[model samples]
Target: MLYLWIKAFHIVFIAAWFAGLFYLPRILVNLAEVPPDSVAERARLIGMAQRLLRFATVLAIPALGLGAWLWLGIGIGKGPGNGWLHAKLALVLLVIGYHHGCGVLLRKFVQGLPTHSPRWYRCFNEVSVLLFAAIVVLVVVKPF
Candidate 1:
C-alpha cells in the first residue's frame, strides 16, 4: 500500500517536473527572440522563467526523493531485471543535467547578456522531449 502511494506521487511529481522541463526551454526561446531594447518585456519573461525554474526545482526534489525511496527502500528494481532501472537512472541524471542547463541559460538571459539564437533554443527545447520519451520507453518497455 505504501509502495502504491509512493508510486502514485512519484508519477504525479515526475509529470509536473517534466512539464517544467518542457516549458522552460520554450521560455528560453522567447527570451532569445525578445527585442534587444524591449526592457519591460524582457524583464517580464525573465521573471516568469525564474519563478518557473524555482517551482520546478522544488517539485523535482520531492519527486527525486520519492523515486529514491521507492527504488532503494521499497525495492522497485531490486534483484534481477534491474538493467532497465540502471538505464532509467542514467536518463534521470540526464534530466537533472538538462534542468541545470535551463538555470544556466536563464542566468545568462537575466544578466542582460547575449545568448544563443532562437533557432538554437528551438533545437534545444526538443531535448527534453527526447529524454522524456526515452525514460518512458525504458520504464514501460523494460526491454533490457
Candidate 2:
C-alpha cells in the first residue's frame, strides 16, 4: 500500500512537472515574438516564465524524491536484468536537462538577448513531447 501511494504521487508530480516543461517554452516562443518596443509585454512574459520555472523546480524535487524512493527504497526496478528502468532513467535525465535549458532561454529573454526565433522555439518545444513519448513507452512496454 505504501508503495502504491508513493507511485501515485510520483506520477502526479511527474505530470505536473511535465506541464511546466511543456508550457514554459511556449512562453519563451511568445516572448521571442513580442515586438522589441513592447517593454510591458516583455516584462510580463518574463515574470510568468520566472514563476513557472520556479514552480517547475519545486515540482521536480518531490517527483525525483518519490521516484528515488520507488527505485531505491521499494526496489521497483532494481534488479540486474531491469535494463528498461535504466533506459527510462536516462530519458528522464534528458528531460531534466531540457527543463534547465528552458531556464537558460528564459534568462536570455530576461536579459534582452534572446537569439532564437519563434520558429526555433516551436521546434524546441517539441523535444519534451518526443522525450515524453519515449519515456512512456519504456515504462509501459519495458522493451529492452
Q: Top TM-score: which candidate number?
A: 1
Candidate 1 segments exceeding 4 Å error: none
List model 1 lDDT by residue over 50-113, tens digit each.
Answer: 9999999999999999999999999888888779999999999999999999999999998877
lDDT, candidate 2, 80-136, per-residue tens: 768999999999899889998999999888777747989999999999989988988
Worst 10 contiguous positions by lDDT, candidate 2: 106-115
lDDT score for residue 54 of model 2? 100
lDDT of 2: 0.92
TM-score of 2: 0.96
* TM-scores for every candidate against the unseen true structure: 0.98, 0.96
The Cα RMSD in angstroms, rounded to one decimal, for candidate 2 relative to the true structure is 0.9
